[model samples]
Target: MQMNGMNIKPVTVILLVLLLVGFYYYYYYYYYLSQYRFNVPPCPTSCSTSEPKDRVPDVIPTDYVFHLKTPDHLQYSQPSIVKGRTDVVAVTPWLAPIVWEGTFNPVLLDSIYKQKKINIAVTVFAVGKYIMFLKNFLETAEKHFFVSFNVHIYVFTDRPKEVPKVNMAPGRQLTVRSVPSSNRWQEISARRMELIQKLIEEQLRKHSDYIFCLDVDSQFHSRWGTESLGGLVAVIHPGYYLDDRGKFPYERRPESRAYVAHGEGDFYYCGGAFGGLLQEVFLLANTCRSNFEEDAKNGIEAAWQEESHLNRYMWINKPSKVLSPEYLWQDFKPRNPEVKTIRFSGVIKNYAAIRPNV
Candidate 1:
């Protein structure tokens, strides 16, 4: 009601007071006292009172490794037959199932993960010229990679403004994170471990059930379904998977943080793409980042930088699922008969020009 030159109403004043009281009650109950709501439940068993460590551990624990033991019923259809046994398919000594096409049915595999209602997070760092590959990479990924499931593509880029727009499908999303660019490809590559370490600790661990670290310079060409899922998974490098262990270019310097003996190599896993459960991925990122930092401190870089450290870590702590080269094929190589499906292929690039300080 206006008192200067208009009529004042008692009913209007009462209504205004009632509305203010209602808003006050709503804010107090919903915002201030929300924790005591009847629908709120207690924290899960895994919740801990101790604060999370702010820094990476000096020594990574290797006394006990996380292993994925498949039940007898869930074993591969064709078991590795030894010495004339008909129903045997060779598996790694560590029980890390080697995945290839025709070894497992995609339908059933997707169904299992669907039942868990898991959300998968894929992280790819696009820097410098690599940013040009995002259009095709993201579009193809939307069509092929875990098409029926919930997937979040986390694209870390130096030029966030230049990130191209791609139409995302239902139950899928893209997040562009701004990261500082580097002149050297080695620095850009090695920094992934550190960035991912922080991302997992600060953000990803709370949202995604599983996490996949991927190379942006690759494209998905076939179905990269839930068959690749496990507690911890690593893909064999297409270039060195067949190479003899003795000749594998593992870090040989004892002073380097990523040192591995000449003859002590499993399948040379690629650094292009790897994934696992959120917690396990966090451990991997943490370990790799810490190792990379230590190597930097000694003024020594591993032979292949982050990849070298990844190989060393996976060797000491075996991957639960070792994907065949089908998971990561290179366009430079001729398609092999054994590679039933090339889920993702790395495109050729002018490395000397793209990489600084070459």
Candidate 2:
């Protein structure tokens, strides 16, 4: 321990050993440990923050993790189990609320979430000539969709250059993430779950409280605020909410991952719009994406692409909130008396004209 020194005490050697150990740790922390902890690969110049550029290896397993939290000072009507919407079923068999016009108090719910500074992420796809719908989709959104709240719209399209610029509200933003153009609209629909799963794992879990995956071909006609937020949310397919489950357009093929046996599905949920707590939608997107790919490998495409898979998944994992057909009425359909308001509805499209392939 003394080396060439004339006199070296045991304490001196011990102190020197301690100092060496400290230096070793300092070097490891600066050169290796810290890098491992904090360094992320430099993002390619081709893909910036607005675009989803990376896939996470350690994607958190989506599990049940949601509990409603409404802060104090939320003044609303007292609940009466018997006084709710009696015309249309207001609650699911499992007790999840069917969101009709009168079932939720928008003012009180918005105030509760506003106080918490909730951020809602909306994902919409407008590829090919579908981009034309982006204009009214966003403009109407500013007017009726989560107004006065922090709304971030993520529009995925192959044609980023053509993304329309509707003036955003103070707390709202529009992001364009380039996606490949698909010849088949069904392929595009299936790919949505893949991209959505990636988006949630890459960013939404940290930055967003909730997410709404909507159809770009649709427009907002009435308020779509906090009343629709929940752990797992599904809007009833306007076409089939009144129809029996036996007639639902679910994938009946046993070979397909989306197969729903007769009399099993609770409701046929529209693929056009469904969302919830970031984690909940993450589960839906991840599961649907996996199932869709599995089915593709076996040469079995569901009847309605992702929509069929969504109904299958929702059947097994019931939605916590079921929005009535009012949430997504088709403009082509005659308005039902039960649809108090068309919060969002799909505009009739000339599919042959806009789609890449008819």
- Per-candidate Cα RMSD to the true structure, in Å, reads 13.2, 8.7
Q: lDDT for each of the candidates? A: 0.77, 0.83
Residue pairs of candidate 2 with colliding backbone atoms: none
| Global CA lDDT computed for model 1 | 0.77
TM-score of each: 0.76, 0.80
List of clashing residue pairs for candidate 1: 79-88, 79-89, 80-88, 80-89, 81-88
> Which tens-of-lDDT digit does each residue in 36-119 have in candidate 1?
322212323432222123432211112212232233355434544343322333368987788877677665565556656668
Best by lDDT: 2
